[model samples]
Target: MDNMVSTCPICHQPTSPEWYFCPNCGKELKAKLIKIPLITQIGIYALSIFLPPLGLWPGIKYLGQKSQEAKMVGIVAITLTIVSSVVTIWLTFHYLQSYLAIYNGLLTNPSGLSSF
Candidate 1:
């Protein structure tokens, strides 16, 4: 009977079945599994677009992985989150500035209200 064995990609050493890591070179023997599922990916995208702050967790998780697809999703989610945050801050500052200007005008010209 012939015995079956696998070889390590890094060191080319014969490895037994069911071994996850190469004993000779310490490289992982198993193929990297897709950690992020389709439904979860869709949810991440949706959260990034609608609720940016909540999307950060999945974005960071995906970014930490080795998969290129996950990295792309992570980058997109992070970019959207940052863009949303910046837009929110800018809008808030602009509206606040407008309110302050209106308040100042009211204070300086109390009779301005009569023109309305």
Candidate 2:
């Protein structure tokens, strides 16, 4: 197949697969895409769940890419990051509120204290 030459659809000019454009007509000859592996996608998702900040980098990076699949992965990663972050923030606030309530109770009830 190395001896075979592919032709440009627009200008019907012979072109090489390695060439990005047709030399004769200047028409684009090859369409290239940045492909991300499934394993890497899973890794990014895991990071998004447990470590959201780390996951955000790949999410934004993939979103900027021209590939549809990469965009999907990016969207998933970002979504996971947002969801996880929201949950984490909510839990932190909830625990803080609980701790504050306990502290206030201890402060108001001086009679219940025993010498330690």
Number of the top candidate by TM-score? 2
Candidate 1: residue 29 Cα off by (Å): 15
Clash pairs, candidate 2, are none
Q: For model 1, how big is the CA root-mean-square deviation?
A: 10.0
Pick the lDDT winner.
Answer: 2
- Candidate 2's C-alpha runs over 4 A off are 1-35, 114-116
Any runs in candidate 1 off by more than 4 Å, and if so which?
1-39, 112-116
Using all chains and alpha carbons, the TM-scores for the candidates as numbered come to 0.60, 0.64
Q: Give residue 53's error in model 1 in angstroms.
A: 2.5
Give candidate 2's whole-model lDDT: 0.85
Backbone clash count for every predicted candidate, in the order shown: 0, 0
Per-model C-alpha lDDT, please? 0.81, 0.85
